[model samples]
Target: MGQSEATVGRWSEATIWLHWLGALLILSALMVGWSAEHLAARDDQPLLFEIHFSIGLLALAVMLARIACRFFQARPDRSQVPPLARFAASTVHLLLYLATFGVLLSGLINFLFLGPVRVFGFVTVPQLFDPEADEWLRALSWYAHVYGWWALTALVLLHAAAAFFHHFVRRDRTLRDFLPGRR
Candidate 1:
């Protein structure tokens, strides 16, 4: 379909682009974080760290935009899905967005507590808080960051599974709305 025409219950071009790009960054950050220790030991570790940090920040920014767009734009008609399913979908989406923001903030705080770290080059991203931050804050933020990863993974899996369920089990357009092309 052409840009001029809107697909029913589907996302706009800008929203779709932001969603996919945010997804990519989130996935990349997770991969980097998983290998952080091993990667940090290397000479290029700082470089890798900066890349991960930058992407995480980018994802955070994109998510903020996503939330704003979600509220401002009209969603595709929910009349197609059962009322319960629609409610579930809305709830899941809200949780996903909140969880995503939490993960990003945890990382940011972790870095801030670590002290001023270079983003990717000699240029440094300023710490949001002073180094040697409170012990409790440090420990809590650390756990939050660690657990955030696991939570994010589980949430994404559930979201993906539900989308597939709608596509296969429900035989609905729920999942297709996010697809690049309308069938």
Candidate 2:
């Protein structure tokens, strides 16, 4: 059955955990990235960049796991939601995923072309592209990463607003479905 037609009541525990974890990781990555870009002093920037890059990589992994879980696990049915609301939710979710992957991929390309990235001084993320010839690619990737982050941030806010609407205004189980022990 389609998401809007199914009658399932709650999301699986794994899905809920993944959703919350991914949210935390993404938020952390965004904060660090913003700091690296706008707040950190030039001397302190490299450390912040490394932290941001590491967090993004971790978020990418979690997102991939979440996608796999979505296919394997049951999701809360949207049958209680209006068709238009369901469509809007799906669109927002799809856009969020696209923006997330865009940011990760572009960041990876930029890092690869710029130089090797050291993650928390433990593991070194090797350079995948030569900087000399791939400067243009790096620049393109930088722009994509920046723009994708903005899009992701906007989408996240919209998503949160929708969730709040469902919880407070609609007075439905929509938000509760993903909350801990809500079933």
Candidate 3:
């Protein structure tokens, strides 16, 4: 009954929606962050920065809600997966959460120290620290934010690859667990 019960349940609707929403937000944030860094012209940079920052903040909120949902929701049982694979999957998921949170937090901290950012010309996000006085902190946060993005990108790739492996090679419901429908 234990094994049967574990295998029978599907992810909750809330979990599925959160999973897809978080993925979309994170991917969008990564692309916007990259564009702001390398593609935007000097004059257009502020707009791009505003979009990127806003998206990061949104991602942070989604991630926090996702974490909370994980605790309250009934996660689909993983007894179907091999122990080693289960461990690996759990590790990847944990790292994904950590990397995302790290990137968002560092970005917010950097912006707070260096900003009075005007978002899309509509609103100004006030600074937490004076840019001139907290230059050192700003630099540290900038480094963390940049490196955290890289780490998050790597983790995302790995996570996607693992899902594909489970779907194509293992032929399992692991990928389906987070996907909408397919109950």
Best by TM-score, which number? 2
Q: How far is candidate 3 from the true structure (C-alpha RMSD, Å)?
A: 3.9
The candidate maximizing lDDT is: 2
Q: Which ten contiguous residues of candidate 3 have the minimum total lDDT?
A: 1-10
Query: Model 3 over residues 1-183: C-alpha lDDT tens digits?
Result: 122232337777776788889889889988988998898898987788888878877878888888877776666766766899789888998898888888888888888874678764577877778878878888888898889989988998898898899899989777776678666
Model 2 misplaced stretches (Cα beyond 4 Å): 1-7
TM-score of candidate 2 on Cα atoms, chains taken together: 0.91
Candidate 3 lDDT at 156 equals 88
Poorest lDDT segment (10 consecutive residues) of candidate 1: 1-10
Which residue pairs come into collision in candidate 3? none
lDDT of 1 by residue, 86-117 (tens): 79888888888878888898888788876578
* Backbone clashes, candidate 2: 0
Clashing residue pairs, backbone N/CA/C < 3 A, model 2 = none
Question: What's the number of clashes in each of the models?
Answer: 0, 0, 0
